[model samples]
Target: MAAYGRGAGVAGREDLPVLLVAVLLAAAACSIAQAQQQPVYTSIYDVISNRSDLSTMKRLVDGLGLANQLTSGTFTAFLPDNNAWAQAFTAAGVTEAQMLTTYRDPATTLVNFHLVSRFTTIVNGSIYNNALKISDLAVNSTRSYDTEAGRADSDYGLALTRAGNDTDGAGGVQVMGRSGPPALIAANQSDIAAGLSYCNVISAVARFWFDTYFDIITKSSVTASSASFAGLVAAGGQQQWLKDTTLTGTLFAPDNAAIAKVQADLKLNFSTALSQQDAADLVRYHMTDVPFNRSAPVNPVATKLKDATLTWNGGQFLSVAGTLGRPSNNVRWVGFPRSASVVPLLDAALLPLPSTAWKLVVAKSAAAGASASSGFSSFIKAMEAQMVVRYQMDDTSKVVTVYAPTDAAFARLESYTGKPFASLASAIKDQIVSMHVTQGAAYTPSGLLTATPLDTMAGSRTLNVTRASNSAAGVQLSGGQTPRGAAAIVASDNVMYGRSIVHTLDQVLIPAGVVLPQGGGGAAGVASAPSGWALLLLVALAVCVQRWALAAA
Candidate 1:
């Protein structure tokens, strides 16, 4: 089949000859008399068969035994010339002598493609003046026609566009097909630009109906391995909306390797029943609302799925990174010839995290705390320097509850140390930071209020939790060193960073054996001396324990 057009509007072809003479005589009389005084015709078959240019279509209709049906119905047909027929014959590898015998049914289907079950007239000054007319792309005059491809619904159809002075100052008309740019409408041998009418039927010279572009679901089923699409289809991702051919769009299908990774990582086995919600959400993320062909404009395009969008990372070696390729409308379904959906064989399955979480960590974190002295910007910076937090960011399963120390808290830690936080050894700093996080569990502030002495990810150390009367002072977490005088929880229950739950603390909690000020008492100064041999041993122990714990994490 020839490539379907997508540019401007166009039409197609079929046959009738003995019917041509009568149509011409009627046309000649109308021209001689007033154009409005034309005789009322019996049906569309009369106009189509009488057109000398539509002889090939006439023969196809006759062979299909649909001549009588055409005469009795009200319909519109985009008839193509004999040139179009000759071209189709050449493409099918059949000569004109074998046209009736070799390509009978195929010719009939082609003719049926041109005949839409509605009466649409595109003449000057009519309701369709400079308007785009459309019809159901079917095999017959009604909804009951059936074929191997299934029944034709409103979702899968054809369109016609009329470009008047609005397009180019000079009026023009074009035909857009289902695939490539629409070709200019070829005039009939009679040189008539306007469509011919008989009774409730109208006929116009147009392009062929070559349904080459596959729908989104069909394209995915073909290009992607059974492992990927089969799971998707089972998950109900291939619903009627995806199967609609009338609306052109794109699909980002993952290959077998990607699907395998998802299965392994998510612990999903396609052998069992699919998780419909998860699979459907993932599939929706891969679909876009625009038809990004090679010629499509480069930009961030929105997807049908809410809050998800796609954009090209131009010049990015996506294949090297394991993605199919850069975002280009030019991408076709892998191993398929000219497909409808742009199937970029993704190296990995796309998993959409909660949008709110992504916005907090990646977007709002910086500006949100910029003006606050007791905000988490300093803790954010410190966490960025650690390799463990970075690893956790990429690991979807590791949920971490972080006790964020504000800028003022870091400054207080500096005052106690008599130096900047960075002046301390990296190992010591890592211990202090590790002491603030509770790994493998995300607790709400209410949960923490009743749970005291929680284990820290720094290996053996534990932190105390306390509940108070005032809302601001309701929940508190204290380091093992200082129980009564410790970091006051300023903000609580914030779970915006994926699996990471954040609770902003007003002060930095000191790890075990970290020295307190000279005037401090109680658990604040467990050691007899600051910088004594005992303090040295505790610091060394904290470092080793933290190193082991980080490795384990």
Candidate 2:
């Protein structure tokens, strides 16, 4: 019986080709049947009508009278599902009847933000090959399609970024609308089974749609024009510059009132002719490399203005600085666009830095640290001897966060090491000083509350960030080669040099060594807190650290 079974298996193997052909034929017939039954959408109306989830969107399309036009056009429609509509209704604080009647045009415009007139079907088969494709909304020519929201026509209008075989070498691919972060097609609602597939293009319902983009120039001109920044157009020739669609940037526009006050403080007349240097300084101080959404608070971002850079964290709530005359002093967000935002500052323009962070530090070190009143002489001498300050100041890419110790901190280090700081080898001095710096990342006092395991410029070493018992201590950041104690970030965000953020530490951070100073491994050094001017000396040391990183870069 076993021999007969083996022979039968062999015969089946020999007839495998015929069996495969039969299976293929069956599959072909099934595909033909499925194709015959496939629902054809003559218009977007048919597509929306087929899905119960898209009922709200269908009402919008019908209300706009775009059913006939959409049916014959090739386009990609990002229809919001029923859940999205419910959320939108709740957010807008309106009932469905009121939305259709009182808010019809506004509702139509909101719906139009989702529609892109193009054949933007995601080729599912090609996605496995890791292709990255982006669609820059091409058909946005007139108010009929995309109504101009802010000052100019949309520059970053509804971009569709598709990644087939994600370039990051990650296994899965994603499709993103330039509204926010990209959503995974396979992971999200790739539920096209219920969709009205057409020959021209297919529409898949999106989890969410992108926000409407507004140009910075347009937002500034309309919202900040009256009281906020009337002279921004006149003083800096910003009217012509911003209107040019080719350039994109973040403009921190001071209100005309604020500008006038600043001018009075400087004793300069706005109406009179000014030097090219002064006008450039006034304009550049308000400019940042990246565009920020004034409507929302932002994470701590670096500004291009270097010395008088606009640096603030999401927690700072800068919008709260100029809005009303109440206790909160909030700044008003006068514009709605994401690409270009207009924020009103009631007080003054950001002043330009006299020199780079490195130069400022070098001066401070010489003036304060080397002086009899300041105790940072030993630390300054060692740094100057090594020329570490030069290296740190030269690098532009790195934003060195220095936890500089006062002269007293160095005195304690000298007492522990059984040698003067200046006597140590150049290599040892470099390692010791480098241990005090956390490279690349910049954290404000508020940002430090959550950041931890901060990597130092010293390779492989790390530090922990924690809040002080008294909020006045700002934040304590500490770590080393060994388990020596924490240093209090006494004065935080007090210094900005080029891109370097300087924080003054109450005690010097010593990496692991045999000579641990008394109370160095513990929080016993808090008594030697730096005065306000002493804190400036600590910032000077950061310039030295920046120079080192720059040389390496």
For each candidate, the alpha-carbon lDDT, in order, equals 0.52, 0.49
User: What TM value does model 2 have?
Assistant: 0.32
User: Compared with the true structure, what per-residue lDDT tens digits does model 2 show for residues 428-465?
Assistant: 67767777666666566676667787776666767777
Model 1, span 1-553: residue lDDT tens = 2436522223322224545777999889878787555434455577566667677777777777778867765444455667766665564456655545665654454456555454345568575412122222222221221221122331223444444422211223343333334433443211122333212112232222233333333432234453465457557555654545454566666657766764453323443423466467666766666655445546555665676555555532122112323332223321111223445454455545432221233332443445455445666677667767545643545666777766877766655555666756787678777788777776777778766678886778788888855437488777865323667777653332224566767777777865444322334433334557878899999999999999999
| TM-scores for the candidates | 0.44, 0.32
**Residue ranges of candidate 2 with Cα displaced over 4 Å:** 1-17, 30-38, 119-156, 163-553
Once model 2 is optimally superposed onto the true structure by TM-score, how far is the C-alpha of residue 369 displaced, in angstroms?
32
What's the lDDT of the predicted structure labeled candidate 1? Answer: 0.52
Output the worst ten-in-a-row residue range by lDDT, candidate 1: 141-150
Best TM-score among the predictions, by candidate number? 1
Off by over 4 Å in 1: 1-52, 55-75, 82-172, 177-338, 342-377, 384-397, 406-418, 425-428, 446-452, 466-476, 480-506, 516-553
Error of 2 at 170 (Å): 13
Error of 1 at 150 (Å): 16
- For model 2, where is the 10-residue window of minimal lDDT? 319-328
